[model samples]
Target: MSNTPSLTANLRSDLPAALVVFFVALPLCLGIALASGAPAFSGLIAGIIGGIVVGALSGSQIGVSGPAAGLAAIVLTAIGSLGFENFLVAVVLGGLIQVGFGLLRAGVIGYYFPSSVIKGMLTGIGLIIILKQIPHFLGYDADYEGDQSFWQVDGENTFTEIINALGNPSVGATTVGFIALGILLLWSNVLSNKGKIFTLIQGPLVAVAAGILYYVLTQGNPTWGVAPEHLVRVPVPKSFDDFLGQFTFPNFGAITNPTIWVTAFTIALVASLETLLCVEATDKLDPAQRVTPTNRELIAQGSGNILSGLIGGLPITQVIVRSSANIQSGGKTKMAAIIHGVFLLLSVIAVPTLLNKIPLAVLAAVLLIVGYKLANPATVSAIYRSGWKQFGPYIVTVLAIVFTDLLTGIALGLVVAIIIILYKSYQNSHFLHRVDSDDAAGRHHVQMQLAEEVTFFNKAAILRELDGLPEGAILELDVRKTRYLDYDIVEILENFATKARDRGIDIEIIAVGKRVMNPPSYMKFFDLAPAVEGH
Candidate 1:
């Protein structure tokens, strides 16, 4: 773990980064809610809780939690199966389950994910972001902003949606998106190096401000003006009382339902897995390479989900997009995430109308830059150079994610990674060499050294080597360096001793640097017979 900057000391950097994340999260919160078929305000509530509560408790400095697009389908189904109020009960129970998972140290499950898969996940998400944002950038708001699934709820797949956007591009939105992109590129490549002014005020904030100004100046011009439908849609309340009325309480009476329990477990498992994965990815993205305590992250996310459910918000999980945005924007502490939540809370109550005035295209442009940074060609090239064993899983994860969904893609990637591991294990179980090729009497002398740990997976390789030994051969089986010898492998050696007798082959078993001629038995030497019999 690396030290995180104190909130007071990191404020200057965190503040600007927070603003950038706020712009990116605002629409995502609403869009995920929309896609989930939940109340629009629920997403906002989740964003606030995820930022304020989870940020405070999480060990992560850069991870940002909110309503994730990955859970949209689950939420939609859960809400439809159980009524909205009953679903809230499930969310609360799910939070409790997540907290239990943290206490049980289930977070260690995250460590099993291969590094190639994690890298693939980041790159896959980057590609998804770019593909999903294209339509929004072209002013075609047919699909929700944060939808990451290849087949969208809007009756079109990722590619089809992009095709549609190309056919019907909005002039005003397109112009503004390109302008925002240009400004972002300029600020990043040129202006930011000029002085402290560019550093203090983020490019995203500037692009948003310019976008609002453009929208205002061209509202009446049909050709150049962005439509109202293409703007951020925050649920605005008519009065302070109405604002407070927005919060919906869960149906405590429905807690006894078995369906609710099932939903709760599903949400808890999925949310915990997503949070753990994001923790790994965020740690990798951190310039300081700080390791976040995974169990603590689970508890933090669980707490956030609890509060979110109580207040009619969606389930919370650490999201990579916002986390990456925080890192790329130079955030040095969790305060950046917390403050972004505060911005969300204050914005809905104070100036939602103003937020609604900003074009979605501008935010789309911001995400475009973030996506490019995540899925850059350099990252792919580096992974490819690591060798096919690594690159296979990395590319598989990327393609699966782009073609399917997040969890499914990760599952497939893990399968590929496991197969690769087995393949490597089979090939590297032992080292065989011909010692002093053919002794004085022309007898073949072969030495086979066992690996540090030899399991049943290595049985085939060892078997092949033993069967290839010629008649009248002198064989030395070395176990001096081996720490673990599986019963299956020992059995193979025991069975081979019988054949060695018929073939006129001499067998020498070396253990602890001592050679035993015609050893009494391999089963007794390795002491694995009883363990295997017990099983």
Candidate 2:
């Protein structure tokens, strides 16, 4: 798929989308860093690398890469075991491993997944976004902002956090959140169409500005004051040198430790999987329906992670949240992603203090819209209409993601989909047509045509049909359409031929080479064909 968006063709569309993605990505960078128990500046570094480096290299038009919430737990544990400095070594090694994965073309694994599971993943992540954002929206900011797992980094599960937030809502934050949500809704559904200025000046930026205004105005009103914790918390550097000092380099001296290698491999595996999955989902979400080069994406992510670790940053992945936000915000090119990275860098250097004043609730409002679009009820209804065969894996994936985590949920959904495939294979091994007319020899004709693939799964079904045949019947078994015939199935057919002879039933085999009447050995009939050149 063509992902090369000409600079002139997409500037107008990409600019506003880039701004929206910047606003969305800023807090997530900080939150995911906090959740990972790393320096807050690390997340920003990763975001910068993911956006500029990965965005420039990736074939994806809308996919946004950054520090992912799904890897927070692993980062936290690794930091505890290896210490922060040494852990950076693992991160760098992981990046190299990812680069190796890309070179090896392991990205093809993404295509093996069923469509039901992919849809389920998208819907599940959408629900997760909405569910995880509630507390932040209500001003209960105990948990980190980008926490997507059911069990949060703050020791609270998804539902329990909402329950707690309901009992302790911040009037100031709630008010700002509602107003921002209103602006977003109005901008998307009404104002954007009425004028180009509204489109250029995206609703998210307006909402954030409004949120900052509210925070400044209500600082002293006890009942309405937005607390420090309820706002964006970017680290403010006092001077140029202080800003430079925030970057922490890896302790490469510890690279020889076996534990470091193991950790590196773990990060590489999980991060690659997450990146591939996001590539598939982001491709599906793109308006142009352009397909991303998965192998190139892995290389891009690896390069980003390596750069991020060299200076101080969390591991990188193609994050669905920011990607979905970019898509929903009208981002049409990789330019949007590249520009968002530039915004992140400029924000850190130029206006961090101003950013810190914006309320988290406003960002939550932006995400709520993104979440709703991804998990639209219309999508669910349409999938349901496709029948249980399609809906089962989709719903399972959705629920599992809600209750567990993204990777685990997809694994479970795949298991269900595979089981369904096997069951269908068992039921559809062959087609049968029996003519009721009796010949002069008092025999009925039965024709059985095999399916494309007759594996061991079909043995039982084929055997049952053969055993039920009448004594005075002429059976014509057709294998011309079969691409693969398992040894188990072939043996079943050979045994059935012997039983047919005893029952006074005539057997005819219609195979690739020729038709045979009551062949002494079915294996010999298959063996007579020339072997494939390669095998």
- Model 2 scores a TM of 0.96
Off by over 4 Å in 2: 1-3, 529-535
Listing every candidate in turn, what is its Cα RMSD in Å to the true structure after a full C-alpha superposition?
A: 2.0, 1.9
Error of 1 at 255 (Å): 0.8
Superpose all Cα atoms of candidate 1 onto the true structure and report the RMSD in Å to 1 decimal. Answer: 2.0
lDDT of 2 by residue, 407-455 (tens): 9999999999999998898888899999988889878899999887788
Find the candidate with the highest TM-score and give its number: 1
**Count of backbone clashes, every candidate in sequence:** 0, 0
- Per-residue CA lDDT of model 1 for 112-198, tens digit only, reads 999999999999999999999999999999999789999999889999999999999999999999999999999999999999999
Model 1 pairs in collision: none
